[model samples]
Target: MPPDPADDREAGTVFLPKFDDRGLLTAIAVDAKNSEILMVAFMNEDALAATRASGAAHFWSRSRQSLWKKGETSGNILRVREILVDCDQDALILRCDPAGPACHTGARSCFYRRLEGEALVRVKT
Candidate 1:
């Protein structure tokens, strides 16, 4: 699919859609070649631009209000292979070559949380 049209490039950064300053990124996902969801992230247009320019997983940290390149400090950077947008242009599928574990805790994936009964269970064992 074609890259997002609103995805403008300037000053070495990317810009994505922000609806009425909602600050909620509506499009994003990470996947491997085999279609496993390696990770997911919310992207501001800037994050999308940075990701496109750098070929790394860059995300807009809503809590931190900054750009965070995945595995930047942890040495787990994802080499983005391609960016896919779903129909309606509101969602994204990122194809990447993960350098190492995707999760910050050193797990292969971020889906470490599981459901046990009604409580959220962390899979550490």
Candidate 2:
């Protein structure tokens, strides 16, 4: 039998997320003003809760195996304006206002490269 609707959807209007095997949900950040995709990351329960509490973007670093606050090192903080979860609740889209570049490469977004035929091209600002 399938799970109850409450377990899958309605749930009395409360938000319920379906995390992956790693207890992480995919998070996509976009620029609130321009709708430009900023970056993609993962959020564990702790990271999600922290982001909700602080109104800032928090992520689980698979490389560091730790919780990370966006812009902790570079001061390019992402202030979350809104968050929308996927229908199945396994992923989230965060609309945010960024203080500076979102990419570690000093680009406005991590998606600064585009595929041109078979070659990767850097998008000119």
Candidate 3:
């Protein structure tokens, strides 16, 4: 039998992830040591399972319509140290040690720009 939601959802030990309508959940990768936000992505069941099994970060590419392991081509893998699920189990934080740049543009973080007055300014690294 399944665990009761009232008892096992927020305060229980059981892990029950609440996926969205697209069978995906929001996942944020952060530097485990410095707490720097690296990137944000989505993960499906297969991506989550792969991440758990491989100790590497994997994500479902919405545009590509496929599951991809980070650093498959760039060798900038996000080595996951810990996975933290939100209280609602709808979002996840992947505490990771990144091998290289997290952004596709070779920025240390995907959020390498800041919104200014009608412009996107590059953040000083």
Candidate 4:
């Protein structure tokens, strides 16, 4: 028999993340100070474990098929402040303090472009 979902939600104890069929969970990182969404990434079991153990943001790259620590190369590391699991436990919110630009393009956020009247407008930083 399957276990009750409430078992995973017991206060101050359990942390049962619900990974998808591909064994990855959608993780959204946001700025701890202003609540600006930084980026969206996927986390495998290993990546999730690493993040919890190290307090750093780690993700599984679908294209690279490997684990990656955020900002490992660009010095834009995300220091995780809190991790909130969705009600369904299928996704996670990572509140973090970013050291530098969150986007690879040197933008503050990956969501810097917005759709406006059939055009993609770049929001000024």
After superposition, which runs of candidate 1 have C-alpha atoms over 4 Å from their true positions?
1-28, 120-125
Please, what is the whole-model Cα lDDT of each candidate in the order they appear?
A: 0.72, 0.93, 0.96, 0.93
Candidate 3: misplaced stretches above 4 Å? 1-6
Model 2 Cα lDDT, one tens digit per residue, 10-47:
44456888889989999999999989999999999999
The alpha-carbon deviation from the true structure for residue 50 of candidate 3, after best TM-score superposition, in angstroms, is 0.1
Which stretches in model 4 have alpha-carbon errors above 4 Å? 1-3, 6-13
True lDDT of residue 104, candidate 1: 80
**Mind giving the per-residue lDDT tens digits that candidate 1 earns over 1-125?**
89655544212144334432645455444556676676777887778889889888788887898989998898998888888765434467788888888888787778778998999888762
Weakest 10 consecutive residues, lDDT, candidate 2?
A: 5-14
Give the CA lDDT, 0 to 100, for residue 11 in model 3: 88
The residue ranges of model 2 lying beyond 4 angstroms of the native Cα positions read 1-3, 6-12
TM-score of each: 0.73, 0.91, 0.95, 0.90
- How many clashing residue pairs, candidate 4? 0
Identify the candidate with maximal lDDT. 3
Between candidates 2 and 3, name the one with more favorable TM-score: 3
